[model samples]
Target: MQKLAGVLQNFFNQAHAKGRLRRECFGNLIYYRLIDDSQPFRRGTVIFEEGTLIPGYPQIGRMIRLDKGLKEQFTKPFWAEEKVDGYNVRIFLLGERLLGVTRGGFLCPFTVDRLPDLIDERIFSDHPDFILCGEIAGPENPYLIGSPPFIKEDIQLFIFDCQRKGEFDYLSQAEKHQLMEHYSLPSVRNFGLFKAEDILAIKQLMMTLDTEGCEGLVFKEDVPRGKRSKYVTSDASLSDIQAMARYLPDFPPEYFIGRILRSVIFLDEEGISSTHELKAQLGSAFIDGLLKAIKQCQREHRVYHRFRCRLHDRANARQLLAHLARGDGHIQIVKHRLVREGEFYIFEFDKVFQRTTGLLGELLSGEMVYD
Candidate 1:
C-alpha cells in the first residue's frame, strides 16, 4: 500500500512537472491533475497502477451545437447509441485481477467491488489486451438520477467502447459488438445506422428516449475515427435545474450557472423558442412541479446571505457574473470580490434574490463548455 501510494504520488509529480496534468476549477469544485486535452492521451498513458486497480480514461463525446445538425457533422451512416445516465467507468484486466476506473481516472471503489461479480473471470483471461468502457449505474450512484432504475442484480457493466491496452485505437463497432457477445458482456442500446438525411428521425428518437426516461443519444460515425456528438435529454435538464438551486449553498454559483446554461442549450437543441413551449413539450405539470420545488428553495433567501465560491474557470465565470449583473432583475450582487488562490479564484459575494427565475435566466445566458 505504501509503495503504491509512493508510486501514485510520484506519477502525479511527473505529470505536473511535464505539464501533462492540470488543476481545472469548475464552479466550487477543484479537479486536481485533470487530463490536459491539448496533449492527447497516447499509448502507455500513466494512469495510476496500484493494488488491483489501474485507473484510466474512457472515450468521451464532444458536445456540438445542435444547429450544426447531425447530418452535417458526420459522413453518411452513423451509430446512435443510447447515452446511459450513470458514472463513466473503464474496466481492465491487470495480471489475474480486474480493475475499474472512473472517467476522471480514479479508482472507483464501488465499481471495483461490484463489477467483478457480474462477469465471468474468463472474459478477462480470454481478452487480456482490451479495456472495456461503460457506465456503473444503479441506486447508489451519486452523480445521476438512474433511469429505468437498476435492480441490484441488473446493476452491471454496459460496455460501449473497447480499446486495446496501451493504445488510443478502439475496436471497430462490429468487432466490439461481436466481442461483447462472445464474452457475454452487456452493452448499451445501439440504434443501428442512420443516413445524413435522417436528422429528423434521429431527433424523434432522442425525444422518444427522453419520454421513456433515458438520458440521450451518442451519435458515432459508422466508420472508425469518425465524429462523435451527444444530445442530452430534457430529463437531464430538469434534474440538473433542480440540483442547481437546491444545492446552491453547497455547490458553487458557476456550477449552478453551468447547469442553467445547459438548460438554454437544451432549448436550442430541441428547437423550442420559449419556456412555454418547453413546458408543453416536457409536460406542463412536470415543469410546474419542479419550479414549485425550486421556488421553495428560492424563498429561503435569509438562509443563504453570504457565499464564498471557488471558480477554477475564472474567465468564463467572470463573463457569466458580468452578464448576470447586467440583466437579472432579482439577485442583486451585494458585494463581489475575488482573490487568486493557486489554480482557483476564491469569489466572495453577497446576494439578495426574491425569485429564482432571474437567476435561472442569467445562467442560461452564460456560455460554458461541458467536460
Candidate 2:
C-alpha cells in the first residue's frame, strides 16, 4: 500500500510538471487533463482535419432539423471558422519534394521564388521530416485583427497543424507543445484546448475575435472524433451548415424545394443588404432572387440540401416558396419558362440565415432554431 501511494504521488507530480492539472485527487489518485501551455506559436503549426475529411468525425456535421415548422426553422447555429484571410497553402511531399501552395493549392509562383532560404531550402530538403501547413500572411491577408494585409517586408507563416514524421499523436497535447517549441516552429496557439461551456463566454470570445479582425474560434474538446467533431456534438448550436448554406450565392438549386431563396451566401463585409429596404427596392431584390431560384429549381433538381416538404394551405406551395425565399435575406426570381399552371409556386429557404448576424448570430439571436 505504501509503495502504491508513493507511485501515485510521483505520477501526479510528473504530470503537474508537464502542464497537466490533477483535477480531483481521490483514493490512490491518478489522472490529469492537459493545461494550456505558456509559449508563443505561429499559425498552421498545428493542423486539424478539414470538413472534407468527414468520416469518423460524424460530429463534423451530424444532425438535422428539416422537419421543424417554418416559423421556427431559421435559427440553427453554423459551426463556422474564420475562413482565414490568407493563402490556403498545403504541405505535402511529392516523391521527395515537399512544398507549400496557394489557397488554390497551387505552388504559389511568387511565393515559390521569393521564399526565404531559411524556409524554402530547409523545408524543401527536409520535406519528409515534417508537414508544414501555414499561410503567407502579409499586407495581402491579415490573419490577426487590426493588422493590415501582407506587407513587402512582412511575410511570415502561421502553422496551425503539426504532423511530424512517424511521431503523430504519440505525444500528449503538452508533449506536442514542447515539440513545437523544440523545433522553433510558429504555431496558431501556445495552448492545447480552451474549453468554454457557457454560451455567453462563447459569444464574448467570438465577438472579441471578430472585432479584433481575427477569424472565428477553433474549438477543440475530447469527444473522440476528429479535432473539430467533439464540439459539434456537444454544441448543438454549432452544426447549422445546411441552414446557413441557402443564403449562399452560388449554391445549387436542385438542393432546395418549392422556391430557392438564394444560390449561395457571401461572407463579405457588406454581407446581405438586408430586410435593408424590404419595402420596395430591397423587397424587389429579395423577390428577384427568389424567382431566379425557382427558375433554377425547374432547370436543375439536384441541390445539395434535403428539406422536408408538406404540400398544404398555410404551407401552400407558393407561400412555402415565399417563406423560404424570405428566410434567406436575399431574393431570386424564376422566369416564365419555369412556373406553370395553378396559383402555385415552389419555395425553399435553404439556409434561412440572417445576413447581418451570419449563422452564428442567428443561433445567438434566436432567429435560427437548431436541434
Using TM-score as the measure, the top candidate is 1
Question: Model 1, 179-220: lDDT tens per residue?
Answer: 878878889999978876776787788778767767778888
Task: Give the runs in model 2 whose Cα sits over 4 Å from its true position.
Answer: 1-83, 92-98, 102-105, 117-127, 141-154, 164-172, 190-192, 222-225, 229-371
| TM-score of candidate 2 on Cα atoms, chains taken together | 0.35
Candidate 1 vs. true structure, TM-score:
0.62
Tens-place lDDT digits, model 2, residues 1-371: 12224544464356457645323211222223223322221212221111011001011222121112111322323222332334545454434443444442223323433344215344435445555555555442211111212234335566555455323332334544565566665545432333333444544444444344453344433332234421111011111222323344443444442122221211111133553332343234445544544444445532223232222232234433442343233333221122322432222223222332243333444685657
lDDT of 2 at 295: 45
Native-to-model Cα distance after best TM-score fit, residue 69 in candidate 1, in Å? 3.1
